[model samples]
Target: MSWIVDRIRPREAPSFSRPLALLVAGALFLENLDGTVLQTAAPAVAQEFEVAPEGVSPAIVGYLLAVAVAIPVAGWVAERFGTRRTFLVSVAGFTAASVACALAPNLLWLCAFRIVQGVAGAMMIPVGRIAVLRSVRPTDLLAAMAYLTWPSLIAPVIAPFLGGVITDVLGWRWIFVLNVPIGMALAVGGALLVPRAEHRIRTPLDRWGYLLTAGTVVCLTGGVELLRDGRPWLVATLLLLSVTLAAAAAHGMTRREHPLFVPEVLRIRTFRAGNLSGSVYRLVITGAPFLFVLLFQAGFGWSAAAAGAMVTAVFAGNLGIKPLTTPIIRLLGFRRTLVWSIVAGGASLLAFAGVHASTPVPAIAVLLVFSGAVRSIGFSAYNTVMFADVPRDLLPAANGLSATLQQVGTALGVAAAAAAAGLGTGIAGPEAVELGYRLAFVPLAGLLVIPLVGALRLPAAAGGHATARR
Candidate 1:
């Protein structure tokens, strides 16, 4: 009778908040899309403001910095204000900021408005994840996480090409303008779909903990951004300070009765694996699109549109593999699945390094498609398994900390890629530009070693609760 009940339970549909999950995914798409969409539009924006193209850097940096500052307090804000209210206000704020960005008459105003958008974004992402974590049953977690992971994967891959097309046809301002309707729809969806906070906690905000963590994020993110600018001394100094602050924050959080994020969350092996090794893995995949563009256009001398069109193979691969990711995870479990994904994904990078201008387009497309599929699978596993063992009470802290580390990974990825490529070029000298581009993938592939080691160390039965394996 017990065996029969267990068997029947596996076939029962897992009840979770699907509409809320979809709403959060859409909001995530908006946040991630905004971060990269403006990259290709910088020149057009500069022309309108009558400044050097590089002058637009402040607008971008300001937005990112504001996000870094706000993420630390996201969990507290949702608890204080209620998730449904916070989510609605965040969407509405972000949408209004977009309108302001579109109407900015100068670079100064644009930077200010972008900062507004960033603050809202910081609130939206972590809080939305908290909502999902609280609502999802263990059985439904993998599917819910798959929905959340898609925006992060899809947005960065398509943003460059989408930005180029939008700039060419609808104009650069339209980038922000288009978000208006989407924001309105999301706002309405949240009001209807998101459950009101079950209860609110009146925990006192930890001022010192917030400062320490925020400082660490600022230093780390700012240091990485400086790498791309060739400011080695400043980058080193900031990164050192970042490390110091991080240590201080960790030590202090453990002692505090009401810390910003409980340090004990990291004691969970699955959570720690996802944050430590998982972050390094994210750094590599995030950088791949940037490297691909440089290889296609700068190395091979292809046209911009041609390069972008070719890159769409990667996007197609990501989408094509989406439906299969969960089933694959269930079959192999997280440990074996992560190991294979990293190995295959790293091999794809090496294969990319060997490509030349004469390589068949079909060959390049197939390689990219394979890489994208593996990348998607690995990411979904890390995202889901990390939360598998976290207690319901700790979900908020875990989500907040995970979201913060993710931002660090994202902030460093492009800079690390650019720096690696630059080093490669210097070694090859001025005459062998293409060889330098090819050598860039060597180190990028090497970044996989950290995660590979971590994945192998994971217990074979790790994350069994989420996977439904015993």
Candidate 2:
């Protein structure tokens, strides 16, 4: 009877493999599409609401905060509900939230809707990833992950352009409205295609741990906002509060029988080093685009469409490097590729500080493209290496922790860049805008050094197949 039950389980029986890839890829594309599609629309939204651009920024911040708060809870939700149910719910929720965002009337309403959208979106990619991992064979895993990675990496490159076109032609609201069909399609496909998995052991939800973690993330993110707003005292106070909350949460979680984040996962040396390195690496890489937008629009006095178009160079570079990534990793191995890519990426960013109005557009485009390509190589290598040592049983916990940390790093990077740009403008006046951008790159370059040190701790053959313990 037990054997029959095992044989009858609804494991993803391999069928229509190509369609399976498309379904997963489509889900990933929509997930990334929403992530970046709003950036270019920010200015338009501000104008519509008759508020300052800075005031409108809360839409972005609020979304990010929601994602950060929701990520850790995903593992528990997935465990309680089966993967199929979770994916369907996540996609459906995101679709509904997207409609709410499209119809929002005022800035306040829009911000509120965006938070809902964030909550819904927070589950899409991670749960989708879990589904893919469970469904695909190990040999096919790399290809599946690569397929997902392309959309995510490419979204930023095309987002500004897409957002600008939509806003300029149809209106800013369409950016959110556009997600309606895409989201609906993904939800239906996920329901139909994703296999149901049996819940082997049900772990009780760590409600207290969830609250403490949520509080810590909110406080820390708020502190970053305070610092950007130039409220030094408030920043300090909030930072202290965040520290206290985080410590308290850590203490409490350690005592729990089923902690939200497993302490044992952190004990793995490679996972720890990979996560730490990846977080810092993302700070500079992720934040650089926000700074560049300001540099092009506010400093160089480029129109939104033109500024958005400039990023195509970066996108082109990203695409050009994709075919080469696996081969390069296979050749140089993981550690070497990651290290050199970081150094190369930092240098490219640092070089951007020298760009000026007198600089030819083509020259600038080349530099941007090169930077994008190098970054793609580095990030993929780092992300892949992080999971190499992670055991199968602990994947859920590791994914949650890594995802949360990455979001935190992204928020910090954006805030830090904004604060630095503000300071640069204050001291130099209008002329200082370019210099502010330049100065911002310096520290971002310095951030790469931290990860480089961490990379040193990884084995020389870290990225090779032999290094995978599973």
Best by lDDT: 1
Point out where model 2 deviates above 4 Å. 1-22, 135-141, 466-470
TM-score for each of the candidates: 0.95, 0.91
- Give the alpha-carbon lDDT of every model: 0.88, 0.77
Q: For model 1, where is the 10-residue window of minimal lDDT?
A: 8-17
Model 1 misplacement above 4 A? 1-10
Q: Kindly list the per-residue Cα lDDT of model 1 for residues 1-470, writing each as its tens digit.
A: 98987887856554567778889999999998888778768889999889997788778767767876888898899999899889999999999999999998889999999999999988899989888778678888898898899998998788878887898899999999999999999999999988874799989998989999889988887887777577789999999999999999888888889999888899999999988999999989988887888788878998666887788788888999999999999999999999999999999999877999999999999998998899999999999989989998889989988998887787677777877788777777889888888899999999999999999999998998899832
Count backbone overlaps in model 2.
0
Task: Please list all clashing residue pairs in model 2, or write none if there are none.
Answer: none
lDDT of 1: 0.88
